[model samples]
Target: MANIGIVIPAAGQGKRMGAGYNKQFLMLMEKPILAHTVRLFEESDFVSEIVIVGAEGDISVIKELVYYQEFHKVAAVCIGGVLRQDSVRAGVRALSPTIQRIVVHDGARPLLTLQAFHKFLEESREYSAAIMGVPIKDTVKRVDIAGKVLDTLPRDYLRAVQTPQIFDREILEEAHQQAASAGYYGTDDASLLEWMGHPVQMVEGMQENIKVTTPEDLLLAERILTQRR
Candidate 1:
């Protein structure tokens, strides 16, 4: 139960965020976004250790934050690659050999409340692989490059997938290896498993579980954080 290891991929440059630096370093309610993300798992009873994958330039920054915050669960801080997939793989490799389960989450998404996190963890225990996703509440559409409506996608089967994707260590490692060997770059970790013919269960996620990609997203996160507080 305490063998669960969490990998946080914080290597994204956040070019769209226009922060002129890694957005995860940006403060949210007086703490770094990445710090907020890690603290959730650190406080959880299920997680035993953590591995953070960051850019080469941000390694010291991340290490400093972990030390200052007294995040004793941090096992390693590894250099990440250009792609998110590569960063996740690096983090997975940093986990201890005894860790039988892995949870990969985005460092920018700091608003994931402990209640939701533990709920997902509890409900996902019966599955080999599980991910959090929210049902698409809005009307959907499929459009072409010319802005022409091709077809209206069914919202009933659509979901906006969020992170903290949980997987068995052995299967996740194998999925990464297969993807690397085949030169397949997937949109997310679940997609990699999907490509490898693995069934991934989708548990209901919160609407506020959004990844901060732009400045607007940061503002929205702030509001949600305040509300949560």
Candidate 2:
């Protein structure tokens, strides 16, 4: 069995959510969104450690949550940076040195299933990098900066990527290091690997495995939880 460490970047202000605070601190069911996400990994059999990277101001709250919840797998709570990528980088550095695999996941995504987690981890052993994504069901259009439609993107060739993206610990660390040296910024953790020419595989992700970013998303997340119950 591989020793896996999960890095959760939860420092975003989520200005779009209009919550006036960190959206991860918002309530999902009876618990905060961040707590729900942490509980998932905390219960995973394959995960050996979890490092949560959040804004410095929220570190105390995160620590209190972990302490009160008795999240034994939570090994560290590191301060985050301005960008999401920066937070992930900090989390990677904060993980236990023994961890062989790294998983980067959004702290607001609470609907990820154990099946997806297990499948990604199993498949990652064969591939250096793997992530969960869903094929686009709706037609997508490529537009210019002025909002002029340039071309219609084939949905077949497109995928809406989600987390948790898994990667070999060394590979991810190297990718981040190279990206930093080159002054490159990737939209997601896997994009950094892609920039390094790493072959990344995708695992089919559930549509319900959505990031809680907006008020509408929160409502849907509640409905999903209710349906599950």
What overall lDDT goes with each candidate model?
A: 0.94, 0.91
RMSD of each: 0.9, 0.9
lDDT of 1: 0.94
Per-residue accuracy of model 2 over 1-229 as CA lDDT, tens digit each: 4578999999998999998889999988989999889998998888899999999999999999999989999999999988998999999999988998899999999999887788767766788899989999999999999999999998888999999898888999999999999999999989998999988898888899999988999999999999999
lDDT of 1 by residue, 1-229 (tens): 5679999999999999998999999988899999999999999998999999999999999999999999999999999998999999999999999999999999999989889999999989999899999998899899999999999998989999999899999999999999999999999999999999999999999999889889899889899888867
Task: Kindly report the root-mean-square deviation of model 2 from the true structure over all alpha carbons.
Answer: 0.9
Global CA lDDT computed for model 2: 0.91
For model 2, the superposed segments whose C-alpha errors exceed 4 Å read none
Clashing pairs in 1: none
Model 2 TM-score on a 0 to 1 scale: 0.97
